[model samples]
Target chain A: MIQKWKNHAEAYLFVTPSVILTVTLGIYPILWALRYMFYDYKGYGEAKFAGLYNIKRLFRDDYLWDAIWNTFVFASGKMILTLPVALLLAVLLNGKLRGRNLLRGIYFMPTIFSTAVMAVVFYLIFNSYNGLLNQILNMIGLPAVEWLNMQNAMLTCIIIAAWGGIGNYMLLFLAGLQGIPKDVYESAELDGATGARRFWSITIPMLGPVLNIIMMLAIMSALESYEAIMVLTGGGPSGATEVMHLYLYKLLFPVSTGETMAQDIGYGSAVAMLLALIVGVITGLYLYLSRKLNDIYS
Target chain B: MTRISGRILTWTFLLITAALLLLPIALAMLGSFKTNQELNAGSALLPKVWQLENYLYTWKEAKFSVYVWNSVIYSVGATITTVTVCSLAAYAVARRSFPGRKLLLGVYSAMMFIHMGVLTLKPAYQIMVTLGLHKSVLGLIIMMTGAGGTTFFILYAFIRSISKELDEAAMIDGASSFYIFSRIILPLCAPALGVVGLFAFRGAWNNYILPLVFTMSQPELQPITVGLANIRYGFGGAVQSHLMLTGACISMLPMLLMYILANKSFVQMNVGAIKG
Candidate 1:
């Protein structure tokens, strides 16, 4: 009994640091956000009990709704462009291709660079006036395009997002691809399965579990992304590229870009809760659907 | 003939995609060497005269010298803290089934999916402020260490995989748990620790939001990400695209080198991730 007590004590001692950090940084902040959701407060000054006032405003706020819509569009656009390309690259590179390691390294390079820094580089390249892309187009006698204009900003953001993401997902897909045993493909070949047929029948089904997890990661990441957009567009050209997180950021820490936004901590917290709910529901839904698909396959 | 054509076709597609993927980075590198005028007006891929001055100007004039140092401190500091805290907790969770272990694991898993995005940034900032550490890099380092949960899970999985006989053998010789952890388990956990360290370093280095918020009042404490953004958005009136590109290259080189050096570890880390 003494020895067991000592073991428990050691365990408690080991976990104490993590528990303190988690509670302080993770759990406490969450509760703080939850509590602040019902109060009217800025970064400074007194807190007033707003009750459901912020929630009511959240429903009516056009900008919040627009941001929510834009977030979905941006996330979906990035997903649509990223996953297939990543998977294709994974498939292409999975074989004993020449310099495949080098190729994979180059592909995954962008995932390591700072997103904000790359976005700045991208900003220069995609600049409407005298940008690298436009300069090339002009030299070839094409009309200059307003790549970051209100209409095209989201699309440009999506392309940049996709470019940054494809490599990481490709790596994920490659890992999954590797897990599908070589014999499965060999047997499929023995049964007269052609390349396309083998890929469709064997590779796709074999990758289902990995695919599900990858999709979840892709969705969460795409939705959470704002740093690139923040640097690239600042969610703008008339708030055209404003995302949910960016919206919250602007509210909480309004960048002094000649536009004075009243810092609404209460509204921002409410928006946060709603955003968390949306993410939870979507993740839950995806998990449920994936489980169903897994059942069917099994 | 079909096989030859197929090989050619595959090479063509791969090369084209690779080139497209690499174009922006290539442009940024070349643009870093070009004068502002040349970059704006000239269509040449190579600069008229390769301007080594752009880098010097960025380093000194744009205050990247300070930013780079801060970034190193932040990344290294956060990495060390995260690894230490998470590994300790991971050891406990993996080896000993103490009370509240289930609750602890459940909370962490739930936290992983919460994805509050930057919604919690304000509260986090407030917490730092309350502690009066908001202005210091140490505060940001502490706050950044909250990425512990993921690291904990990773280390937990890795530690669990380590053979139990080593611990049992050590224990039979009257080795204390701490002694076993430090001497035996830690030496064995080097690979996982390396992976976790790299990840923590990368996350901390690339982190923009927390650093941006915390260092809002303290510009000198800003990391390269925030500093680079400031050069683009906050610096003076005119856009210094050349300097920005140079700064970008400077910021990218360290991570690029690390990636090259530890390329195998990176792939191994990803594989470990999926398995976990």
Candidate 2:
């Protein structure tokens, strides 16, 4: 009995630090944010109960709505660009290609760098007047494009996002590809499925579950991404590229000179709650759809 | 002839993709060595004179040394704490049947998917301030260590895969749980711990917003990510594009080296994660 108690004590002690940190840092902040959703409080000063004013404001806020629309566009654009490319790259690389490891390393290189720093490098490359791309265009006697202007800023952001993300999704797809047994492919080949037909019929089905999960991850990450955008454009040229999180960030921590509003923690918390809801609903919907997909496969 | 053509096509396609992917990084590296004038001119792919002093300027004049030290402390501190806390928690959940075990597991799994992103940044900083830790690197490390649920789950799966016979045998020899855990299990868990440590270090090292928000008041506490952004956005007049690229290269080197050294483990870790 004493030993049993001691064992329990030992287990509890082991989990204690994690529990404390999670509650203080993870769970507590969430609750605080949730609570602050209904209150009017900045980073400083006394809190005042604003009831549903923040929520009402959120419903009517044009900037927040624009940000939401932009986020959807950005996320969808990134998804469309990244997923197919990643899948194709994974398919190409998963074979017994020579120097495939080196190829994989090169492809996955972008995933490891700081997005902020890379976005700056990209800024230098994509700068309109004297940027690398424009300079090359001028040299080639082609018209120089304004890559970071209002018209092209979102596309530029999406392109940068796709570049950073393709490697990660490719890795996920590679893992899935590796799991499909060699004999399965051989059997398919014996049955006369060849090339693209073999891939469509066998490989796609085999990768369904991983593909679903990767899609969900990719979408969630795309929606949540702001660091690259923040660095590249600071949500740019007229808030044309402002996504949901970047909007919230600007609300919470407004830059001094940009076209940001005064810090509005109350409204920002409301935005945070709304953003969380948006993410949650989309994730839940994706999970449900993926479940339906798995059922069909099974 | 068809097979030869197909193989050639595949190689051509792959080489093209690889070059396109590498172009930005290659440009950054080469551009970092060029004079500001040449870089702005943007005509030359190769630097006429390799301005090696760009690195020196970034390190000293841009105050990257301070940022690098802070990042080292933050990453190392977070990695150690995350590894320790997660390993202990994982061991408990994996080996022992305890009160709230199901609840703990449920919360952790939920937390893994519930990425609040920067939603919690404000309140997290507030909590740090309340604890009088907001201004310090230790505070940032502590807050960073909070989101280790994924690490815990990974380690839990790993520890569960480890045999229980070792624990039973250790118990039969009158070994305490802590002793078995420390002396026996920990050494065995070295690989999982190493993977987790690498991930924890990377996450902390590359983390932007949390450190950005928390260290806003204290410039000295800013990590490399924040420092790099500052040089881009907050630098008074002329954007030091060359110095910024140099800093970007400097910031990337450690992670690049780590990835090179542990290439297999880095690849395998993601594979294992997705499989789980």
Candidate 3:
């Protein structure tokens, strides 16, 4: 009994720090955030018994709805562009071309830089007057356009996200490609399966699991994208690029504009909870379907 | 002749794609050395005169030194804590058949999904306040170390992949569990540790939201991400784009240098997911 107790103690001792910190920082805050969903408070202010008021406010809040719409558009836009481009790059770099490793390294460079830094740089590049893109346009005798205008802001954010992100996904896809046995491709080629045919028939089937993971990652990252939009546009040109996380930040920290945006923790928590639920449902559904697909594969 | 042309075509396509991908970063590097006036009077990609003084101006004007040190501290502190704590926990879970071992692994894997997003801000702040970690760089590092995400799962897999007979051999010689862990398991897991260290470093270094929230009142404590955002918002329309680009390049330098030095290991990170 004592030995069993000691084993248990040792196990607990080994795992205690991680478990405590994860619970404190991860699980506890989530539960706490959920708790804040019910009460009315302004971040540090006193809580009042205002059940579901925040949710009701959220339901009627058009700006919240607009932010939600913009987020989906942004996430979908990023995934749509990023995955295919990454796959193409991965395929190109996966070959026995000269300087393949050098090309791959260059492609993967953007993944290392801070998003805020890149976004700031891109903001300058996309600046209305003296930006690089505009300079190029003018040199070619085209008029300078506002890239961060209401119609174009989300697209600009999407492009920047894709530019910084494709490298990482491409690396993942390259690894996935390399994992396939040479014999599989050789056999396919011997049977006259070449180029697009080989890619579809052999490569795609083999990369099933990796593709699922990449897709899931793309979805999750896109959904939670805040930094790119926040740094580049500040959800500006009339809130065109405001993603859900930025909306949540604006709720709590209300970026000062002389006329203060309300700092309501309760409302922010409710919106955050709703956003979390949407992400959760989408993730859960994806996982469920992917598991079913895995069963079929097995 | 057809085959030769095909090779040239493929090479040209790859070259163009690489150039397009690298153009923004190259522009930032080049533009950082230009005068603000040259940047303004510009259709030129190349600066008329290389203003190496732009670096010094950005360093002083933007307080780049303070933010760089803060970033280094956060990345190093968080990386060490995360790697140490996570490797210890991962070893315990992956090796030992203890009570609640499965339960522990399940919790870690479950967190791999179910991202609560920024909703944790209020309570995270509260916890920081209670622990007097708010507005402190150390607090931000602690919060970062608490993220038992990809690193934990990857380390768990890495530990599991090692042979069990090694542990048995150590036991036969009367080595303690801690001794075996320190001497045998850790050294074996160095490659995995390197990958985790890189990831932890990048995550802490690039993290904008947590540091932004934690170091709101303490400007000096903020990392480069928050610092750059401050420069963007504070100056609004009046801020010189060239100066900001110089700051951006400054922020990119360490990561770029690390990647260049350890290019092989950086590419090897992708395999971690495939193994998992």
Candidate 4:
């Protein structure tokens, strides 16, 4: 018993720092947040219980639906657009390309740039006036409009998100593509499943497992599109691109013209709790679906 | 046969996509060589006039030296600590047959969500205040470690791929857990560590949100990411292609070098991640 206890202490000590920080930050704060969610507390002071009022308020919120729809549309748009683009690029680059190595490094650049820096660059490039895109459009005779404003905020955000994300998924897809045994492709080709036929029959079907993970990752990131919004639009031009996570952030911070910062602390926590549950549930569903698909593939 | 045309089409498509991928970078690099006036009106493919002094101008006028130095300190400090701590924790989780292994792994998965998503702002502020970590580089470093648990999980997955025969042999020879970890396991795990370190370094260097919220108004403590963000606030109606391009190039240098050095392992490690 003593020897077993000694081993336990050693393991405990080894993982203690990470565990302590994780639990304090990871587990306890979450628990604290959950408890705080039921209260009518602002951020600076004590929290008071308000029953399910905060959650009840959540169901009637207009922006919640807007945020949810934006999140889904943004996430689905990227999954649909970026994944195939990444897959096609992965297949193209997986072949005997001369500059594959150089191209890989080039692709990784946007991914490596801090989100702040990426927002900075794209903000400049996609600016409504005198930015690169509009400037080019002027040369080709197209009138310019505010990209981050009411017209196409979510679309612009999705494009930016896809640009930042494609490199990551491209790399992941590249890894998945290369792992498909050359023998499988060779056999399929011998059976006259070359090129397009091979991709549909052999490449994609074989890449299914990896694709599942990649799709799930892309979707999860799409659901949590706060950083892009925070850095790029700040959900601006009259809340045109207000995603749920960003909305929750604004609730916590309270940046509206009239509302004080501390006024919505309790309200924000309730919203955050719901947001976490939604993100958690979506992620769980992806894992369950992917596992089922994985079993079928195997 | 369409083989010749297939090869041509492949090269053409990749080259076009590659050009699109490389646009901002190439423009940024070329802009670094142009005068302010020339940059605003210059072609995208090439600068109308070469004015390398823009590099010197921003380097001095913008105080990029301090920003770059601070970036180095935060990124390096965070990477060394995260890689060391995460690797040790991961080693224990992998090798030690503890009762809470499953629970610990679940915590690791949950860590990914809390570290960066909706909980990022509040929990970080709360922890920093409680731990007296507000506004200090080391505090930022600590939060960064927690932020990097996904990285730890990735490394753990890699470590699981190697056989346990070496550690088993070491244990038989009276090597202590720390000894076996430092000498045998850590050394063998260098390649994985490199991948982890690159990610940690890039993440630290590029992290905007944590540093944005955590650091007080001390400009001296600001990293390159924040410095670039400053450019946005002062982004008067004109295009500062020369300045933006120079900044992007400077910011990309360290990550670019690491990406080149570890490209192969990066790919291999990712393959391991998906397959597992």
The C-alpha stretches of model 2 lying farther than 4 A from their native spots are A255-259, A296-298
**Candidate 3 lDDT score at position B174:** 87
lDDT of 3 at B252: 90
- Fnat by candidate, in order: 0.76, 0.59, 0.69, 0.42
Docking class of 1: medium
Against the reference, the lDDT scores of all candidates come to: 0.88, 0.86, 0.84, 0.74
Error of 3 at A78 (Å): 0.8
Off by over 4 Å in 4: A140-146, A254-263, A287-298, B1-5, B35-45, B113-118, B235-245
lDDT of 1 at A134: 93
Q: Give the per-residue lDDT of model 1 (tens digit) for A145-263.
A: 99999899999999999999988899999999999999888887889987788889988988988998899988888888899999889989999999998887888778633447878
Q: Candidate 3's residue-wise lDDT over B109-198, tens digit each?
A: 787776767667668788888988787777888888944777888898899999999998998998878998999999999999998899
For model 2, name the residue pairs that clash: none
Candidate 2 at residue B222, lDDT?
91
| Two-way lDDT contest, 1 vs 2, winner | 1
| Interface alpha-carbon RMSD, every candidate | 1.3, 1.4, 1.6, 2.8
Query: How should the candidates be ordered by TM-score, best one leading?
Result: 1, 2, 3, 4
Encode model 1's per-residue lDDT on B97-194: one tens digit a residue: 88898999999888888866776677777778889989898998997885455678889999999999999999999999999999998999999999
**Which tens-of-lDDT digit does each residue in B53-171 have in candidate 4?**
77786778877888898889988998888887788788888888788988988868766655235455576677777778777888877777743366678768767877899989988
Scored against the true structure, residue A197 in model 3 reaches a CA lDDT of 92
Q: Which prediction has the highest lDDT against the true structure?
A: 1
Q: Model 4 over residues A1-298: C-alpha lDDT tens digits? A: 9978877778877888777767765677677767777888777667778988888988898878788777777788767777887788888878777778888777766776677676767776677756666766776888876787687777888888777777788889988887789998888777887699988888888888788778767777778767767767877667777788877766765532123334476677777777777878887898898888778967
